[model samples]
Target: MGGEHSPHVPERVPSDDDPADDLPDGLLVADRDGRVVVFNSAARRMTGIAASAALGRDFRDVLPLHDAEGRDWWKCLSPYEGLTIRTRHPERSLFLADGHELLVTAGYRRDAEGRVERFSVCLRDAAHRARQERDRADLVSTVAHELRSPLTSVKGFTATLLAKWTRFNDDQKRVMLETVNADADRVTRLITELLDVSRIEAGRLEMHRQVVDLAGEARKVIAGRVAAGDPEDRFRFEARGELPEMWLDPDKVDQILGNLVENAVRHGAGTVTIVVEPDAHKEGAAVTVRDEGEGIPPEAAQRVFRQFWRGPGGNRRGGTGLGLYIVKGLVEAHGGAITVRRGPEGGAEFRFTVPAGAPDYAS
Candidate 1:
């Protein structure tokens, strides 16, 4: 099927004024006769075929693409024989003879009678799409791994309790039931995290505005840690200035503080400190959480808030790494910003500020 192209094929070197060369993706245009008449610089670069060699050549000969099943894509397309009303082929993954993959889309330019006058093919790198697939795979792996432990405990305990109901004393039975309850709560929390991640990513995170006491929220978080078996003496709360009531989402504030304080305990060490004060720049509030442990490395400060980030104690400490990312999203949704730095005690310090909602602010 390969043959010499038309000698009459027009050719011109692409220059700054050439709009086709400015395209981010490769573009190739061919006439009705099927010879490449417009091969932009991007096309030449993507295909590694010089303009001089491609301009006068058959479009299929210039770039031989095949489908995953090894079918010749150009023949499958049959651009010249498609339905008269068909003007485009949606983007799909294709491969060159050498096995390099590309994202391709085709368009047909037609005349009044619906006769093909010319056609164009667009080309894009497949890296971005491949990355998305990998990220999805990682999410599946994480969810499965996290669910396995709690679900296994729940199943084992329930089955054992049912099988040996009369063999165990009340105290032993109570312990098993309590363990099952904790595992169930773990599953529920994991599911909630998944939902929160989806909502945050889709920009659907909702907020309910109400008058709130910022310092009081911090105390509630510490009290929760104390109730959860953490030493009451291991945490401290400080208010530097007069606190003012502001309109904010109480649940979101609780969630934010809870995640930060938990992170300090899990990844850091020693006493945890919470500082709340009036926002000097805005009629809002600012809070800082610090711990007396090895802080986040300077090199990793920026990536700490990203999804799936892990610290030095990663595998040793249980976490999905979505905590800080969710914390960031929640804070930003509240018209606030968060940052991390080395604290005065040479430990990790996370500081976040939230703006007071507008007087007329409503959910």
Candidate 2:
């Protein structure tokens, strides 16, 4: 016979010995005395606690409640009645525990007499989803930064070259004309990257196969950038081994190198050195561009390649911010990887790999 009580009892009463009392979903039951009567398998899985040990203990002992400020949270529970509790902190993303993040909903349950009986919580891991959101935001910002400066120069200089070309002497005319043409080429590259990155995101960037002499191409890019006014003494280029012509897309390789060079010039101080090292694992070559300027802050390293990721302390000198991000994307498109680290003499260094091959120079 049961003790005299109201007809409104718990939907399911869990005994200390009944296996069926334990549910796969988070379930907890407390008695009128405010002691735990049942803490089921489901509850244990969500909170990472053992059900057997929670039985006969206070509910607070099972899941020690902590307020958003890390203060005691159980005092907020109502002794007269149970109520659902939703998180109030909008910035509280997800619960972090044991190197993992869990999405959770917490609530309370009561008996027919309006007495608190249980506190239930459900949770699911959310790391993958959060990472995807972060990556997407970074891509957008990167593209925006990369386009701003070159577009400004291409537009401003082309107009200046046009407005002043007729007033110049023959030598001046030749120089100004060459500069105009170079700026045009830079614009073309910006547009191409905008489209290429979009396609890469949509899984659309295609590689045209051909023999590519990376050394010659690198030298040509260096020559053009140097001619365009990057100081000659401040820049050095080298090749370590006899690089054989292999198959790859030349335009993409050019874009990658150009972006890295631009990054070195924009972020680093003093001289920038380009070092090419051959790699057997890649059957390709590793290219490193290092500068003597101040290195990126430790906190900003991982975020450097993210899209639209502006450097700390706002507009980094003359950088529009898209160089590193576009460099990473272009290298990955060529089946390569790109990374940055502090250089030997307290500046930023960018490194990427390219298949040792010949590329079709733009006609």
Identify the leading candidate in terms of TM-score. 1
Q: Please, what are the lDDT tens digits per residue for candidate 1 over residues 144-190?
A: 98899989999999999999999999999999999999889988887
Model 2 ranges with Cα > 4 A deviation: 1-192, 280-282, 312-319, 356-363
Residue 101's lDDT in candidate 2: 47
Clashing pairs in 1: none
Q: Which candidate ranks first by lDDT, i.e. highest? A: 1
**Residue 175, model 1, lDDT:** 97
- On residues 1-363, what C-alpha lDDT tens digit does candidate 2 reach at each position? 112333444334445766734443445555655456666665566567765666666665655645445554445544324343432213223433343445545555665655545545444435655786887787666656666666676677667767887776888766766776766676676676567657866767677767777777778778888899877897898889865565767787787778787777776788888887786576888888898988888888899986556654456464445566777777886778877888998888888886654455212
TM-score (C-alpha, index-matched) for candidate 1:
0.71
- TM-score per candidate, chains pooled: 0.71, 0.51
Clashes of each: 0, 18
| Minimal lDDT window, size 10, model 2 | 84-93
Q: Model 1 Cα displacement at 156 (Å)? A: 1.4
Instruction: Judge candidate 1 at residue 78 and give its lDDT.
Output: 82
